[model samples]
Target chain A: MPDARSTPVTAAILVIGDEILSGRTKDKNIGYIAEYLTSSGIDLREVRVVPDVAEEIVAAVNALRARYTYLFTTGGIGPTHDDITADCVAQALGVGIDVDPRARAMLLERIKEADLNEARLRMARIPFGAELIENAVSKAPGFMIENVIVMAGVPAIMQSMLDAVAPRLRTGARVTAETIEAGNLPEGGYASDLALVAKAHPGVSIGSYPSMTPAGFRNQIVVRGRDGEAVAAARAAVEALVARLHAARG
Target chain B: MPDARSTPVTAAILVIGDEILSGRTKDKNIGYIAEYLTSSGIDLREVRVVPDVAEEIVAAVNALRARYTYLFTTGGIGPTHDDITADCVAQALGVGIDVDPRARAMLLERIKEADLNEARLRMARIPFGAELIENAVSKAPGFMIENVIVMAGVPAIMQSMLDAVAPRLRTGARVTAETIEAGNLPEGGYASDLALVAKAHPGVSIGSYPSMTPAGFRNQIVVRGRDGEAVAAARAAVEALVARLHAARG
Candidate 1:
């Protein structure tokens, strides 16, 4: 059996909302969570954005939860009618959901007793046997059931929830990355050589990314791996290839 | 049978890139395509971002293609070794892929024949039975096979390819949206009333979006539907509810 420390921990993110699908709101959470997970030693393998339909949310929750070590979802955890993530998660997990005393207390921090109507209480709904994740920005807590961690859609609130829940997660070896700038050096010039470097390094992943700037196509070759030495070796090879191409051009 | 014209046209976006999954590149194509599809009368149903791993790419392509009316993929169509989207799409659809003469001609517009080495020639590879989608910014063409449209990852190139392909697609009734700004009035105050309004308007989708501004929480209630009359009616109801809440506060 492989050592527990060597086994990779992977995750998937589910972003739920109709606004994101309609392009009314550009998603800020997916990228933020991806970077956060990368830095935290959790590999973000996949991301899906689904609308606020119950079946879609429930199906995605079940599918993703079974596939990854952790499934983190953002959105639809508010007081409004469309905020149905908690119930959907409960349904997905086959667990009963009710107003949790802990979550209610958290909500009470921001809302007055008289104002804690049915609508506000919706924010306090937690699945059975789930643990509440604290929110620093807003008091309505996010929750974790099984491997799924649900959080708010708002970026600030989501960031806070992530911070609260991150410490409890099982993390793998941190993947280190080295970026080699191949500025103005056309991808075609180094594509074949980079392919060879990538093939030689079995442990690392090498990618050539080209973005169009006002000046022209700015290219970046990135080498990444769980092993720092592998990443550095592949990065060095890529650098050498770029240098060779530059010299040949001269 | 339902009217063919009234039947909703749906799409899913499959973003194939390690850069996006690793958070090295923040995805700009998903939002751009989402808004474009909304305007073009196609409901953007789901989105998935997967790494450049061939199996993952093939699985996502097959699943999304089978589920939605159309599936659009971005990234991995470049000249580099990691640019394996074409081969993956071909494998998913069970079709043969090769360097197409048409695509070669298109590439020739931008690249000299002498410089069209094996790496550069990789850009000309197309699935056997796919129609090329034109890229105005960069000449290497995208392609459409059956219901799946494969485009470049670069935002500008993807936009141009989308523009080229949009005219040929069968579109549904364009969904219209009206935004009612619910300034400063707390969501808790109007949540219940808004739920009733949503229930009353069966034809429209009502979503209350709250964003944190420097000043405070700025809320917008959006009413969206294919029927303009239904959308307008829901918008009016929401407007009245907001007014009532403001009057009560005053």
Candidate 2:
């Protein structure tokens, strides 16, 4: 259990890969990262997916890090020429990047002496002054420096890295969520009324999710809040709206 | 099968919702749309998620529509105050927006006459010169103007709307795919050699998917090409690399 009163945490995700932009690979990372950060009580403000270009990576890294409390980057950290995250992070932070002795030693533990070639060595490069974030699944560790955490693009490795860093991250009050399923009712039919409910309860967030059914359109109005009482109050209002809708239909 | 030969089809997805930015909602629409476009031979070039703010929506809509062959927006099409996709699209195209008679007629057919209030009427609005893309599950149809298509963010509705519009879209030559799985090998260990292999196969796209098991990390390299022979050639090179990895380990 990490500290929940972590002075209001905020995070941004930078997804790196041309595959994402080209729609060759639909990114699964943004959703996973967003959910993880939110559950940890860290506000996830924005997500940007840049190509494999070094300049774009550096620019995005610099901009996101400057704006958010923590910046997490996924992808572009492989052993190929395209895998330039380590170097880009160094350039972004204006620090020297090289194969760190510590990282190299970790790599040595995993690979056979005969297999310790140039390609394998590429994974050992770390930005100066960065602390290694462990990858439990693989020996190739991710790194964190100046509030920016760089993890692998692959979901499994990224998850392992996130689990490793979770203990170290600061947290805040977790939000409580409640959903009221307004089945077969169009969201527009209740917009003004829901807006009033939202206004009446300033602390709670009211979101409507519309779903289409065999019969007609349906909406699930979700009320979220940090305070339990406030969330309950908002839920009650949503229930009232649903009851009214049923009555009118009847 | 649609004719995907004459015109090179392209699409950009605009995800709209404050919940997405606030991390309250994790967007799943992009992946679904990406997969859909690829199978249809429509190249999805860019994706941008903007907050439900009209200005941002207007700007993103204009930019993406100009750059891509088709622009698809998901979310903010519901009947809430935040659901302002219609108004924003109208503004983006510099056209008059109102409760169109056709859309209103559709809503009237779906909803009880007694419950058809002003709030419900909001869902009937469409931008001028826009053609309706039917939401088969729900009566409310998505609208398309020029190359811009405004559909619901809800996955089901979005999918339905896509099915409706997909038939009408001009597509291109379908890209074929091939895969070679290199079991229990870190991508770094094969990076340089694989880079050469990739360089040699210029027409094919070689993507490395790293998977983690209880034993170790495994990389699955997928080669995509327009020509079947090129795809097979790339797969042969990948198989050779996998064999080399095994021999090296022995």
Candidate 3:
């Protein structure tokens, strides 16, 4: 709790859409959000994908925002009838929502009058006391109420909106990563030795990712730590284990 | 609902772990589950990833299982202290759980006596009325109780278990997909025209995906339907629309 490794900023992602659930659309937002959050030094700790149901959306928003330092949501902010993220966010916060002048002004720039019907009007509503997160490509803006940042779910639009919002987030000390590729060893074979290395380096995180290569299944042990010295120490231990594994194989 | 679509078998995926949320792990499970369920003719209508918390997992299981035909969970069934999915699943169903004779018999095949301690005993706990799903790579068998299929979080193991389970599931009529790539067009520009096409194809689902190619941004229109003939008709209309778009650009 001493903030020695910088203030740890934890965040969550809420993806709302029926398309994702139906398998009609494969999600590309989670990866982009994860990469963006990591590079910005915010630890993204949780993500939930719920349907357009107002009750479910409200529940997820309340739960995630309470737990994480920042809650980022994508999807359900479109002009379609199924798009209900705006109203859901408003209800979750127990605040009145209407077409904010700032939001309406922004939408009017890209959308024509006839195109902007009552259905389109739904996208302009923001919770009271919320700050609009600018959408660069499309005029419809995402809004941030307290710790929750509500953004569009479309990958292109979401990326554009994230570009406009990421600069404003509070960042912690960046966690650096190093990987050691251990060839052709099943995770079970190295499980005991790896466990010992993990216990020794308490400050570092060691993850075993078994990947299928052209040669066959190769396990890559990744060591991550805020302290470079601890990470190096863990990496050395992993290398020694890998050498022993090779000798045993021979 | 009539049995016209072959009984509409529905399934939900519960992704467990803090790593996925923290962006340390980009989840490959949901996509694999979605694709696998669709291929097996099971309608995967929902997916949720909860943390290593008991209350959250119990609530999700209760809600999703009641609404869907089947529920599949990945992650948290490991030997570590954070691994608590098996116990939570048992608690959710209000069933008596201990190391089932069969489960213990299977685990004993691969793991040694010293390795299978009190901590590892947690993995062997199977709820009442549960049946084991075979894990070809490792001895830790996945369990199926009621409508929920508890599989490993690792992609390879999950895939193998899914392959084993697919044959046993009651399948509906297989849904078919068709794509019409619209080269270099923005989604908003063709919004009105696409709406007309969507209206025409009432039975088919038409989605416009905006993508970046070597030439720049392009829109790929996809048509999905249960009827092959209906999907082809929708695809033809989309192709015409894309052609008109190209001519207009020229």
* Candidates 1 and 2 compared by lDDT, better number: 1
User: What would the C-alpha RMSD of candidate 1 be, to one decimal place?
Assistant: 1.3
Model 3 residue A114 distance off true place after TM-score fit, in angstroms? 6.3
Q: Report the lDDT of model 1 for residue A163.
A: 95
Candidate 2 wrong stretches, greater than 4 Å: A1-8, A18-27, A50-59, A91-95, A167-173, A183-188, A212-218, A226-232, A247-250, B1-9, B18-26, B227-232, B247-250
Instruction: Go through the candidates in order and give each one's DockQ.
Output: 0.87, 0.40, 0.28
Summarize candidate 3's per-residue lDDT along B194-215 as a digit string, tens digits: 7788888888777665555557
lDDT of each: 0.94, 0.82, 0.80
lDDT of 2 by residue, A21-63 (tens): 5565667788788778878888776676676778879988998
- Could you give the DockQ of candidate 2? 0.40
Q: Each candidate's TM vs. the true structure?
A: 0.98, 0.86, 0.77
Whole-model lDDT, model 2:
0.82
> What is candidate 3's lDDT per residue for A1-250, written digit by digit as tens?
5583766888888888766766667898997798788777787776778766789899989988998989999987865445678899999999999988899889889878766766566678899999999988777899888998999877888999898888887778777778888878656567667878989999987776555566766767788778899999999999999999889889
Query: What's model 1's TM-score?
Result: 0.98
10 residues in a row with least lDDT, candidate 3 chain B = B208-217
| Candidate 3 segments exceeding 4 Å error | A1-7, A112-117, A227-229, B1-9, B38-41, B51-68, B76-129, B136-140, B170-250
- Rank list by TM-score: 1, 2, 3
> Ten consecutive residues with minimal summed lDDT in candidate 2 chain B?
B1-10
